[model samples]
Target: MTIRPIVRYPDPRLVLPAQPVTVFDYALRALAADLLETIHAAPGIGITAPHIGVSLRVVVLDLDPVEGARTYVNPEIIWASPEMILHREGSVSMPGVNDEVSRHARVRISYQDVDGNLQTEESEGLRAVCHQHEIDQLNGVFWIKRLSRLKRERLIKRFEKMSRN
Candidate 1:
């Protein structure tokens, strides 16, 4: 397993929009593999290519062990339910800090697999939350940005303190 280093929070790369994967080849497969390894090492339920400074529109989610991990290339939300849910969200980039964020309770996403095959998925609950979260990351919107300014500032302070200790 090749575990790539995760880019820490506040890195400009984390806020830069990721480039879409246009080539579906061995190298793309390798990057997906590396992403799976990296997310597992991060011990996170979901992760994006930007999390590892790849600047590619890729995401890996291991929300269900029985289902195994899934890779999404150039994932984007195609539709969202009117219902909303509050879920605690965090990031591998900014570990040890999390806050509740409101998100669509259900979402339909259009994406490509590692092989560059187009696919779509409809998800709810935690899976839906993860879909939105990682897609936001790919769009250069970190999870913390979903929080209110006050909450974001507080969370950053907490993270900063944790880093120092």
Candidate 2:
């Protein structure tokens, strides 16, 4: 599988919601494989199909190499813990910027495995944060939006300056 191009921040495509994966086939498997490669190349812990301009509800993650790559197709958060925690958040799309963002410390997610079988799992700490972050990407919300207005503006300005060099 080829390493697909990742859609960058501020691109309209990144803001558009992804469509659900209705077919589980070779193409879907190939896309997940490509996503795994692309995310590893991007050096990110997780990635969504939308990250590569593929408008499908899919995400790939490998927070721990020992656990290897984990794929989530048609993923959704079914429940979130009331007790919140602050975890630093960033995006492969935005790069070079991150900030502490509050999120549910634990989450229960319902998603399809790479084979398209329904699977559910609960996670906490960094793993939970990654899930929420990537799931937001699937919903067309950029991680930076979790920042305060001042922070968001500052980060965007910083990103702009970096882009100019």
> In terms of TM-score, which candidate is strongest?
1
Per-model tally of clashing residue pairs: 0, 0
| Candidate 2 TM-score over all chains jointly | 0.97
lDDT (Cα atoms) of all candidates against the true structure:
0.92, 0.91
lDDT of 2 at 71: 92
Tell how far residue 25 is off in model 1, in angstroms. 0.8
Task: State how far residue 104 of model 1 sits from its true place (Å).
Answer: 0.1
Residue 61 lDDT in candidate 1: 93
| Candidate 2: stretches off by over 4 Å | none
TM-score, one value per model: 0.98, 0.97
Q: How well is each residue in 93-133 modelled by candidate 2, as lDDT tens digits?
A: 98887889999999999999877799999999998999999
**Candidate 1 weakest ten by summed lDDT:** 39-48
Worst 10 residues of 2 by lDDT: 88-97
TM-score, structure 1 vs. true: 0.98
Error of 2 at 75 (Å): 0.8
lDDT of 1 by residue, 1-165 (tens): 489999998899999999999999998888888888988888888988898889899898998879998999999999999999999999999999899999999999999988878999999999999999999999999989988899999999999999999
